[model samples]
Target: MKKDIHIPVVEDVYIAIVNEYNAIYKTQDWNAYIINNKAVDLELVLIVTSGYSKKKATSVFRKKLDKLPKQSYAKIELMQEELFALNNTFKVTFFEGNQMFDKTYLFRENTINLKALQSIPLMAVKGVLAK
Candidate 1:
């Protein structure tokens, strides 16, 4: 008789937050905040995608975090134009212990709070602006 091997899946170890940052100069930017809620460190890769056509999707941004400590978070920023053009979706892949995990989040999902983004602090400018 042949036996089947099974692996357990972990749930809710990481959380993602999407928000908008209004710059001091009247410009706006979008940000994705990845928070690790697990007790151990993690290695993560973040990919942003958007619908390119009726049947196809395209990647707009890619970032990798070699190590995200437990209970820590990382912020990834995007320009307003890019966020609007890309339609704002995220695919996050991470490694915890010996297992790998992956999940996708859409902009319209309830997990992402767009209204809270407005309360985020604005980006500060350190240099003078040119006319």
Candidate 2:
């Protein structure tokens, strides 16, 4: 039975942390975003995020979308500078037609920094991508 079971691979989807200027706060802030680079739309998208260290952990956050169009992106949450010290995780699950896909993206402690910024797909700004 195990050999007959099939788990679809999740591809062309990413969780990125972008450093953007907050117009209201008048300071630089880090924001989490979900990028869907696949050609087909994603349905019933669900994401859970959290940060943790050996001694402490942040609260788990949940977000959902009814549908995410292809080659588009959406903001997931705002990340505080303090969270950078912990291991951040984003767990994503979504359906494409009748198939369901799941993936977990992680940013190791202190990995989300200016020096790691790169040109993120499906977005105009430079950001750090979760692996």
Candidate 3:
């Protein structure tokens, strides 16, 4: 990974969004997952911990920002480091509301699904969770 890629360890991430999340990352966190956004096709992915639902995560982040962002926000990106690493491969759901129009995708080793990604508008990727 490149030094300026923004993939800081979880602790460094805490320092950035702590006050807003009661020091919890799941509520608000993220950094570039690849050495360069282009490395992952400029896709800013986050590895996240399980247990919390997307709705809960979105609500907390909105409350912290003091306003709701119309488009999805890349909140709570999972940490990738010795102390806090997430799954190397995972899936994300894309949609325009009541409909889950497409199938899930699998991502691994900094590689993502271009086909599935193309289906999602960049603005709608926020609050997405990978499992």
lDDT of 2: 0.96
| Model 3 per-residue lDDT tens digits across residues 22-114 | 265356333322111111121223232222232322211111222222323333344322212222322222222333222222222222222
For this target, which candidate reaches the highest lDDT against the unseen true structure?
A: 2
lDDT tens digits by residue: candidate 1, 42-92? 875555545343444555677788888876667755434333433356667
lDDT of 2 by residue, 71-105 (tens): 99999999989999999999999999999999999
- Candidate 2, superposed: residue stretches over 4 Å from native: none
Q: How much is 71 displaced in model 3, in angstroms? A: 3.6
How many steric clashes does model 3 contain? 4
True-structure lDDT of candidate 1 = 0.51
- Model 1 residue 6 lDDT score: 49
Per-model TM-score on C-alpha atoms:
0.57, 0.97, 0.24
